[model samples]
Target chain A: MSSVVIVGAGLGGLRAAEALRANGFTGTITVVGDEVHLPYNRPPLSKEALAGGVDVPGLEFRRKASIEDVDWRLGSAAVSSDLAERTVTLADGTTLAFDGLVVASGIRPRRLPIPGPQEGRHVLRTAADAHAVRDRLRPGTHVLIMGAGFIGCETAATARALGAEVAIVAIDEQPMVRPLGAELGAGMRRRHEEHGVRFHLGHSIDSFVGDDHVQVAVLSDGTELPADVVIEAVGSVANVEWLAGNDLDLSDGLLTDSAMQVATSSAPVVAVGDIARHPNALFGSVARRIEHWNMPTETGRRAGATLAALLAGDEPDRGPFCAMPSFWSDQYHHKLQSFGMPGIADRIELVEGSVDGPCIVEYHDASGLVGVVGVDRTQELAPYRKQLAARAG
Target chain B: MTVKVFVDMDKCQHYGQCCFEASDVFELDEDGKLQYVAEADESRRDDIESAADVCPMQAISVE
Candidate 1:
């Protein structure tokens, strides 16, 4: 009899447990999570959940019949781990030994170290964060967003919908330049601006000006913006501190092989989701951790299969792990859907229509077509997805 | 094992991700809305399961 411990009870952990059962692993599976709530959808936390209200129970992931018996140790975060001893110590000092380990600890919002009044500060990551932000997003409230990524842009749209005066301050030239290229990103910025959202591009928050609550936001460019509620959607840091002394690659996230295995054979440990920097054959041999909505199921399925084979004393097939990363963003009526890594593209050409309206964009590097993003062009994307996969494969 | 598939339309975003996984079971109509067959063959269980799993909104449920 063997037991497996999976850290993080989000989509990644839940899928890993289901994958283990689907692979016929009848061992005890325990999922330890920092959050009290079970695995729920986080995307809505910035959009619908943030706008209307945070529905913690309604946002939960549907439990597959196979993983119904998994021991869900929620609310207790993993404080530390002894990989050599095969034991995990929780925050409450409870130590549990396991034969298998799955690292799905995920990430947290990265906050800038600017001196500020913390009372009106917020980050849209967890449900609680969404709830807290939602309370402050009343009509006519001045919402100052600190990032222009998907989360920041989405939060801006949500705040605008709630009648909040929205303003985005970031160092990027466009809203999503890193991922959607300058043309599309600028197009998105135009759309946001049309909706009354102000942009403070190429600026950083120098410090906050307030006694207790955030009354104003002072920018690096010496511009002062009145901010009633400050939402920091800058980025995220991988939560890999628990496995600090394990001698694993924690530079950005935990590094793993294509099979999601943390090592060759020292232990049966695999990492998944946002924490697992696993290599994808679709994007060369670069092991990058993607924070898209689909990576959990993709990596968890692969990780579970690898762990199950190891536990059965059989060598798992060492095939190159390949998964087409897909993500969709809904701000206002425009639905931005994408397949493949658009960020790595050197050339971005608009194939159909204009950027402000419905359009399709192709992202290509020197190698050829790398990704495709379609706005309100859902039906036409299937062919592009297949073509990209075949070309990359 | 004939799987009974039920999709909560209220929750469906019509992202058409499920159509990629199980094209025969879930399809996006001309209006780009989701339309699905409630009943599917057991042989297509893996693909249907993948369809339900890949759904961004998690609106599909197969039994």
Candidate 2:
């Protein structure tokens, strides 16, 4: 009859609840989320969902039967948590005590500090955000996307697919250069340019110019571009404000041990998904925060198992959480899949296929093969990923 | 015994992630469309189930 409380009823929270049950933990489970809606798939929010191809219900991860046993606190945000009392206070002024806690609060999109009435500006993080952005992407609308990251590029692609004129203002020299390296990132930039999307690379926004809403963006190099709608895809900040007084390492995110256990908390608390910045042995035991799609499933399983063991008064098994990080993106006609951390690589070698066609690129640093990025070549990338995972262990 | 696999085409993006999990059971055609065997030997249940788990769209199900 142990009681476990999980914050953030997104993919990570939902999967952690399932894993807790699957691990034979017959405990009272409670999940709290700020959104009123149930846990849904987020990857589609920037792709098919933004393109008006899929509805909100279609993005859900589970049906009623899948999560019927858990107590769901939808639309309630956890405002604060008392470590010594093992209690969480919600925004609605309700507090819940727990024997075990899982922090999967995830991240929120970072916004630019611009003065003006914030309208016609969008950030695709939630279902509502996607809906608002999609509604504004009319046939002749002009969209100015800020940042060349995954979200920005995906939003640009979706905007173009919906017959909207898109222009990207990225601080990076080329689109996705930091993540996919120069060659593949350039290839992707070329593909987007061929599809009628404009790129203002190596540029920063000076100011957002408009009367009521953003209509034009003035660049740092003294160029003003007309924009009907502005989308900020800059980056995300970890949602770790609730655990403020816990004395945990909050340098980047909720710092966890190799097992995802809260390193500084005396209480049994673990973190998972995008908000959990722990030592990943795959990247040479580097403490990194991965914001990829597959991280929740992998980290949630580990965190759930660890918490279940601690709650059952049994010592958890000892092993470095070495889940191979992988993520995929669909832009234009290319399905880009990447495994391992490519951003840390010093050299990128083209292993198979051509840059314009389906290809696989291997990332290597001083150590060895660090990662691989492939376009529509999942089958070819499988063996390499397995090999990389083996090396990680 | 036979393992039955089901994929909701409406949800499937044809990413071929399932094909990588269970190559013998699921295959993407020349046009990158997904094609799969309706039923397979029970010995391949683990492979098929892995396919169901790795699907990003959650379109694949096994019975």
Best by lDDT: 1
Two-chain DockQ for model 2: 0.37
Q: Which ranges in model 2 have alpha carbons more than 4 Å from their true place?
A: A63-66, B1-3, B19-35, B40-50
lDDT of 2 by residue, A3-117 (tens): 9999998888987887787677888999999998888888888888888654767777753234578999999899999988999999999999999999999999998886654
Global local distance difference test of model 1: 0.91
On DockQ, the leading prediction is 1
As a TM-score, model 2 comes out at 0.94
Worst 10-residue lDDT window for candidate 2 chain A reads A59-68
The superposed Cα distance between candidate 1 and the true structure at residue A179, in angstroms, equals: 0.7
The clash numbers for all candidates, in the given order, read 0, 0
DockQ, per model, reads 0.80, 0.37
Top-TM-score structure, candidate number = 1
TM-score, every prediction: 0.98, 0.94
